[model samples]
Target chain A: MFNAIVSADTLRATLDSVSVLVDECKIHLTDEGIEIRAVDPANVGMVDLRLDATAFESYETDGGIIGVNLSRLEEFAGMADAGQLIQLELDEETRKLHVQIDGLEGTLALIDPDSIRQEPDLPDLDLPARVVLEGKDIDRAVTAADMVSDHIALGVETDEEAFYVDAEGDTDDVHFELGRDDLIDLVAGDAHSLFSLDYLKDMNKAIPKDAEIEMELGEEFPVKMHFDIAEGDGTVTYMLAPRIQSD
Target chain B: MFNAIVSADTLRATLDSVSVLVDECKIHLTDEGIEIRAVDPANVGMVDLRLDATAFESYETDGGIIGVNLSRLEEFAGMADAGQLIQLELDEETRKLHVQIDGLEGTLALIDPDSIRQEPDLPDLDLPARVVLEGKDIDRAVTAADMVSDHIALGVETDEEAFYVDAEGDTDDVHFELGRDDLIDLVAGDAHSLFSLDYLKDMNKAIPKDAEIEMELGEEFPVKMHFDIAEGDGTVTYMLAPRIQSD
Candidate 1:
């Protein structure tokens, strides 16, 4: 019902964003583009993704939803080099996806959409603080925090006009700070939250280092992180539930 | 007392060369340079290494022997980036090595020289065929063979004037060939040997890709792979025992 040609980097980025939260996802094929929404089994995190038809070199669709194993698709996508075009066509009759890249061609069996978990609705929250910075900056801070603790605290210091990532271990601590001068943009507000590093680490791996990440935060509330892909033709949003500070 | 300053890359290459065979080794610090010779616990392989004083940024010694844990040294050396100078000083009183790289400094306790295994004498071998080729070429063939089988056969065909690496798996087979023209140099003669990939794979990791590797082979005999390091100021030779082919 759908056919498209996308670069390997774009395909990998698209799959990586959703694969971190769920193994299988339902992809919506529409006249405009592709849409995917999935939540982790524990309901700790969720991902909302959109890849416009403009993101692909060629796109055609009859508008249908298909379920796919994200890991399996990622493996095939990884076979292609950067900038290499990957052609994907749905074989509706055989319930498989025909993929071609370079000289390699293979068919991946699709999962029945009905067997997958239903997509969850995105929740609305009044997250007051917004900060935008390079993905590499956030990734580096997360990596450093992971070395000292299993949980990290993220907050914006209104008085100092700065955003900071902090983690405390049994005997050591790591702290990273970025001021208004260092960030791409910032909307200062009272915001602070604690989140598990386990999920954040996996999510960070899928993010392109140089991509600018927009983050929204609130007091003890879930954090929403957004980033653009496919040359701004696509966008991905990740929502992670925070861990309450027991003390 | 002994003190030396070497690039991170050179130190890594030196440690990697011998660590593949043994965990601990006695390093001979002479007025000229450093020498290390060790055999694996299983006695299936050996590594001989030599580093001239000119390989280091600065070198000084009192001509003594010291035993060290290769893995421990490798960890500290790894802290430095490529081409970054790493200073190593011996504390004779405490029997420790003071390592400094960039802004990081740490001390590693040395093992008693008497506790480590004695160095093995290099065996004299009369190989009929010799081949000089890029380390990457051989590494590529070994890597490809490793995927299909645990053992590989290496030989030179006199009539074809070529060198070949072949491995046969349960259902898959991989063969790599390098004719006289493709290699740096080749001596056509009668030589064939079957070796366990398990050992060869580790040895290959320490060999620099672009370095020219000199290989000597004979029927059912060990392989002597030699390569230069520190821009020819150092040398490493790996010897692996041959696995008999029952068929």
Candidate 2:
């Protein structure tokens, strides 16, 4: 069982960060906090989310896994305004979530755990290249590329002093450069990857503007994006499979 | 030929306030200002919009009718941020309206005035009951009704010092009362009319929140709603035909 009073924005950010990658997932509530890890339907991407108890106004729970339909939660979450206190209570008997906001109560039916895919075991693989920057800077580059193509190339140019994103369209292409001066921090590395903007755009939409985003990348390999939300009380990471580079 | 530099808000408000009823309109640019009066497609409603020279940063025009597609203008207006100066130039030789916002120029081809329906003469009938209140108050009432039904009954209670908006659904009904203390001015008469919430909700969506909305009503007659925009430099009036009362 679990009961908590959380700021609406934090709850929304948490749910939104996961809903983009999967419609439903098992959320584990424990003494530490809450954790959700899932993969996209096509297995091209994955999301790992963790929220500490400090993220909520007041939280109490005996560790348990609750199957949640994130899209349904987001629908009701829309009724809440930012900073408003939202009360959440889990009923193990009925397997439902009771959400209350502004004196209105709503119940969301939970899915059966046995009906969902098993949680993915996140591998402990080491990635060589890493760059840290603000989420908005990456979001801006993605938007610029959307105007030109369906995919964007993210990489470290050998002779350049900044991280780069390039998109090539049928008739026009766009290139965006963010030097160390423009970024929160830049680590020069020999890493490059081509990713489908379709996936990047959807994942980026849920990240808050002021979040610090960390990119872990390798040549023609998957890209891992990590960002903290809920004022550093929670973390969300997205791993997207890279597209084969085309000339 | 006509040319003027109007703030993006005034331009947007002007087009949006009228576009709710009619998609295409003939705007008369004269020495006084700009005026547009058009009826909705089904001829059940009419909108009269006027923007004085004071509404524009700079105004100069030789009196002439300029046919405009409001949907096209609204599309471009979406690009402008608030308070940005938008330049509008009517190219008579090419029959196009050139709108420039943020260094981007889009030209809308003007429809031939003779191709559209003729403008209806606004009748000078005197409406007995008038209620002067904030646009937001009435807008709120309309929104409440929309949740229950497509029509609303607007009237004044005989013994109460308040204006009443009532809507009845199949199983539920809602009543909103705004007393004199909540209104700017209240002149109640023996007046009540049933109007489609469909029209009121759409028209109110474009009105600014703080603007004063003057409502004129009479028994079984069309309702006239007047509101000022751009700090009173412009005026917009909506006349909606009442829906016949049903038992």
* DockQ, Cα level, model 2: 0.04
| Model 1 lDDT per residue over A3-55, tens place | 99999989998999999889999999999999999999988889999999999
Residue B118 in model 2: lDDT? 78
What tens digits encode model 2's per-residue C-alpha lDDT throughout B1-247?
7899999888988998988888899999998899999988888888888999889988889879988878988888888899698989999899999888878998989988877777877677698778888877776677656655789888876568678887776533456777788889888786789998888887888767888889888887888989998789989988888999999
Clashing pairs in 1: none
Q: What is the lDDT of residue A133 in candidate 2?
A: 83
Considering just the first chain, candidate 2 attains a TM-score of 0.95
- Which residue pairs collide, candidate 2? none
Tens digit of lDDT per residue, candidate 1, span B1-247?
8999999999998999899888999999999999999999888889999999999999999999999988877876776679799999998998878777643445677889999997888798989999999999988999999999999999999999999999999999999999999999999778889999989998988889999999999989999999999899999999888998868
Interface RMSD for candidate 1 relative to the native interface: 7.8
lDDT of 2 by residue, A113-156 (tens): 77877777666557766778888888899999999999999987
